[model samples]
Structures are given as C-alpha cells and as structure tokens.
Target: MTDRVAIVTGGSGGIGRAVSERLAADGISVLVTFSGGSQRADDVVTAITDAGGRAVAARADVAEPAEVNALLDVAEAEFGGVDVVVNTAGIMRLSPLAQLSLDDLDAMYRVNVRGTFVVSQAAVQRLRSGGALINFSSSVVKLALPTYSAYVAGKAAVDGITRILAQEVRGRDITVNAVAPGPTATPLFLDGKPTEVVEHLAAQAPLERLGEPKDIAEAVSFLAGPARWVNGQVVYVNGGIV
Candidate 1:
C-alpha cells in the first residue's frame, strides 16, 4: 500500500487513531483529519512519523460538504491521490425513545449520516480506480439496545448507503463497506456512564469485555488493503457481542 494515500476522519481519538496508525504502518500515506483536537491529531501524526511512517494532520468538520471537499483537496495535494477513505467521526447520546428530542436526532444525523455521505461523496470523486471507502457503523444496530435508538438509526443509514454505494461504483474498482463495532473502550463509550454501568456493559459482551480500538482497526486494515472482495457488507467487530 506504499503507493496509496488514505484519509481517516476523527483521527485524533480511539478507533480513528488506531486506524490511522495501522494504515501508516502498512506504508500508506495517511491524512489524519480532526474536528477540534488539533493537538491530539498532531500527536498521532508525530507518533506515526516517529515510527517511520508518513502522515499529516488537518482540521475539518466532516458534516460540511465544503470542509470535506477541502480536506480531499489537501490530501490530493500532499499525497497525489486518495486510495482509501475511512469515516470514523460520529457522536452519540443516550435517551429513551419518548425522551429523545428532535434536536438530538438531528445532531446525530448531521455528523453520523450526513457527514459520512459528504465525505464519501468527496472521496468517490477523487479516489483512484482501486480506492476503498470504509464507513463506521455500530453493533447496536443488531443488539437493539435501548437508549441508543437515535445513534443506531443513524448508523443504519450508513449501512444502507454502503450497500447502494458499492452498486453505484460497480464498474469502477472502488469498494464501499461499513464496519460495525460493539462497545469499544473509547472516551465516547465512557462518557455519561457510571463505573458500575460501564462494567456491566462490558461484561454483557460474549468476550467478557468491551472491544479495543485496535480490534476495529484491524478489520479496517483488512478492508482497506487485501480484502477487496469484501464489499457492500457490514462486518461486525464486536467480539461476538452481536
């Protein structure tokens, strides 16, 4: 993959960082995009560079089509072309269906659904012939957990888009797929949950613990690299939770 250029959104945190590092390790020139955490993004780039990998950090809000396009422009200018695009930027909120507000729904959709769409659209335009688009979904779509209706719904849309996108780009060598992870041990998973609640959630998984960011990243690496036959599918990396 040394000849490839990759763009990973939300590259400052958890799964995004792992994905960026893994791709960089594989000899792909990585563009790490962050929304607000420029320091953390730079840290990731530094880590990769220190390890003898090529990478750059840029700030962009994936929800805005303009920003997404600009991010592509930067990647193209720096790396010559984009061969892989990973959309890992998303948000979540816990609320019962009755208590879920429209604002909450819109907020989640804006970042999760709309953001993935915009980023994927931009990538499709500039992606090389053998390009791959890996999008983030969630195991909650299959687990059907309560209080995650809005978040899961948004991911479901990503799943749908992934399938249709593959067909749309059928003639091209580009492949589109979604990776749905179970409860990963990220800051986002820890937020708003009590210690006991977090433990219980972890234990609920069949593997007896929550997933690691690298676990999901491994799947992403396969899809972005040698797993070209795997397209238009949602590969769940939830440690058998779903």
Candidate 2:
C-alpha cells in the first residue's frame, strides 16, 4: 500500500500549487482541483507528476455538493483512499462595510464559509482513520483591515468551523485545523494592491517581508504529517504579524 492521498482544492492557485507540490514531495498522491482554471490545474498536476509523484487534476466547485462528491470519487478511485484534505480554495472581494455589496459578500460566503462546511462535512464521512482536514483562514481576521470586512467575516466563520469540526470528530482520530496566513505574495494578495501598499504590508511582518506560498505550505505540511498532537487549532503562518 502507498502512503496517504490528498485533495488540494484551489490547487491551481499560488498557495494551492505550493501545497500540492509540497505534499507530493512528502510521498502523497494528490488530486489537484480547480473551479475555473483548468489549464492552471493541469499545470500543477504536471509539475507534481514530473517530479516523480502521483497526481491528478479534477474540477470542482467546492460550494456544490455534487461536484465536490465527484471530486472525492476521483481521488478515491485513483489514489485508493483520501487521508488529507486541504481547503485552500477561496475568493476575496474587499470593501468597507459601508460600501460592501451583498452580492460580493454572498460570493465570499459561498466559497469560503459554506464551501469549507460542505467539504469538511464530506471529508469527515470519508476520510480514513488518522486523517486530517485543513482549512484556510486569514490573518485579516485579527488585523481587522478596513476594506476587508466581508472577506474577514468569512474567514472568521472558517475559524469557527475548524474548532467545532475538531470536536465533532472526537473519536475518529481525524485532525481538523486552519492555517491563518498573513500577507503573502500570491496572485490573490497582489492582484490589486499598489506597489507601495504591498511594500508597506510586507514590512509590517516581523520577518520584514511578505510570506511566500512555500512558507504557508510548510505550515500545511506540518499539520498533515508528524503533528498528530496538534489539532483543533488555527496556526498563524505569518511571521510574527499578530
């Protein structure tokens, strides 16, 4: 028998790609999932397989139960069984509460909060013993940035789910946790920020630089393997930006 298998939602995105690659390097087969970026998803699969690891690309809208179920099917059929699920998939639309659109808030909830719930629900049912479920929260939940009210609200919900899910799976020996990363250099983080704003945020970290996707991946790796005692916790992967 092989080692554990993993499903990395948003595996095509910056942080997702780094995590997929990292887990694959740890000798796990991965199902790299994407909602819209098929080409990017394929690229991630290729990167993993090219490096002598096993991986497959699957498309899934985490908010849709049918699609997520199908994705889990693919992982099980291809890799034997699922042991870890890393829900790094999310969308962020920033606006101060006064001007925030309900539509944007709804979209964020669908993918961030509801999506995590949907996936975790399924993962708890199917994950083999000693499995792990990891979700993504954000440092913004603590930072309380002005324009991030909606996005941070969604992440705060994720934090809640992570804690509750950890307790819900009490006898199952499955670890549920969340990684709250500080400002990282990914497309999602850098998309709209000006260069000066980016520089300022990067300098805010005690490490005096923006975290890389690989840095966040390291945190995920720890949770997925050799960190059995660490459960029901939200790890801040930020470099002392609390």
Model number with the top lDDT: 2
Candidate 1: stretches off by over 4 Å: none
- Candidate 2 clashing pairs? none
Q: TM-score for every candidate vs. truth?
A: 0.97, 0.98
Candidate 1 overall lDDT versus native? 0.92
List, residue by residue over 117-223, the lDDT tens digit for candidate 2.
99999899999998999999999999978899889989999999999999999998999999999999998999999999999999998789999999999999999
The pairs that clash in candidate 1 are none
Task: Give candidate 2's error at residue 211 in angstroms.
Answer: 0.3
**Steric overlap count per candidate:** 0, 0
